[model samples]
Target: MPKKRRRISAFFKILTVLTVACGVLVAGGYYVIRSVQRVELTPPPPPSGCTLTAAGDTDELEVEQAANAATISGVAFGRDLPPHAVVVAFATVWQESKFRNIEFGDRDSVGLFQQRPSQEWGDPEQLMDPVYSSGEFYDGLVEIAGYEEMPVYEAAQAVQRSADGFAYDQHERRSRTMAAAFTGAEGPAVTCWYDTDEAGEADVEAAQAEMDRVFGTDGALPAAESRTGDPGWAMAAWAVANAERYGLTSVEYGGQRWSAAEGIDGWTEAPGEGGGAAAEDQVVLR
Candidate 1:
């Protein structure tokens, strides 16, 4: 009887050990799963404005001003002006409106270039329109003799006649960087990120309409239905420049992608359907 009791006690001890071990394993597994869930549920970083650092690399902002600057340069490109012309246009606006479509400035100035209605730049309403203002800037720009050979600031001042002629030079380096990026001279160099939750969803129709308003009538843009291929890259760059204003979360071209959630990290190899060289002939904006 004593031996039998000892055997029974040993069995209970083994059972207890097994039960404790199993509970510990179950608890550990639960902790691991919960940890993974917590990580997965964490939200992406919020969106901010576009960026183009002074060093000509890495940058963030609302993309509206950026888009406007791009459009100004785009108009120059459409007119067959060299890249330097675009640089001059961008630098001019960087000094004038900081690329914004403002209604007021020093004196009676208005718009991105701050063209004064009194000075014959245009009516306030016309100057306020980016396309018209950009056209006006370019129109004045082309009239200067050998403006392309002159320094970017000098070229800008020749047209602007600002009180301070040297001011435009201060933005030359940065403007060149932006012009290169937006003009697609530097392949997917311009990248931006935004907070989708705050901005809501993107509107493709609005994007198409806006494109038509700016570059369409001049035959400078691809078909409104197309967003891929070489022409697609141009449209993609424009869309990226306008990302903040349009609630665009992502833009992909040439096997890379930029996400508003990615902030100033800039472009990266696209992931899955979102990144990588676009297999389709259309640019994807979401």
Candidate 2:
């Protein structure tokens, strides 16, 4: 009976060892498999706002400038102005304020275009407004004979009448980049990453009102109810240009999405509602 008991006890000990060994093998196999598998991590998008370069290079302020430049050029295009006008406007602004709407400048030079109130550009208050300053610049530009045929810097200098005529030349390349991206001449050219966390909900109403304030009540924007196509893209691009000030989170068009949180250097495929590149489309923000 004692021998029989000993045998049973030994058998139980073997069973226990086997159970622990199996557990160790199972755990080891799991670790090996996990280590061998490749885990792909999606890179985080850029900071919110806009990035103009292909390399995802740009700051919030510069992105704001790009967006404002888009609005300026967009308004010109809406008025049936030639493409050179947009380019010239961009270069001029780049030279003047680096696209900032400053309240101060060299001897009272103020606003995005650096239009001096002393020069009769407008009141100090009017010059602070980007739309008003852009209009003033265009007003002077269109008056120059054969301005359309002139070079971009020359055209800008003519309108600006700057002390140094060659200064505008420095901004020509960046101006062209911005003009092309915002004009929709280049597809998926402009991408902006902004702060969606603090931005809260998209403000379509404020965006529309600001659009009207800048582009005017003309047919520049689609009806509040809907938008699509090139016009839709144009409007959406405008929203992208102003995304920083407006708390706009994303602007979708042409089967692509530009999100502030995505920090994507450029537009990426967004194949869903309001994401199609149709003639009538929506500009999503928030």
Maximum-lDDT candidate:
1
lDDT of 2 by residue, 110-169 (tens): 888888888999999998887888888888998999998998889888888899978888
**Relative to the true structure, how large is the alpha-carbon lDDT of every model?**
0.73, 0.70
In terms of lDDT, model 2 sits at 0.70
Candidate 1 residues lying further than 4 Å off, grouped into runs, are 1-47, 53-56, 60-62, 217-232, 261-265, 270-282
Across 63-154, the per-residue lDDT of candidate 1 in tens digits comes to 67778866775565445567788888888888888877899988899999999999998899999998898888888988999998999999
TM-score for each of the candidates: 0.72, 0.72
Deviating ranges (above 4 Å) for candidate 2 = 1-49, 53-61, 217-231, 273-286
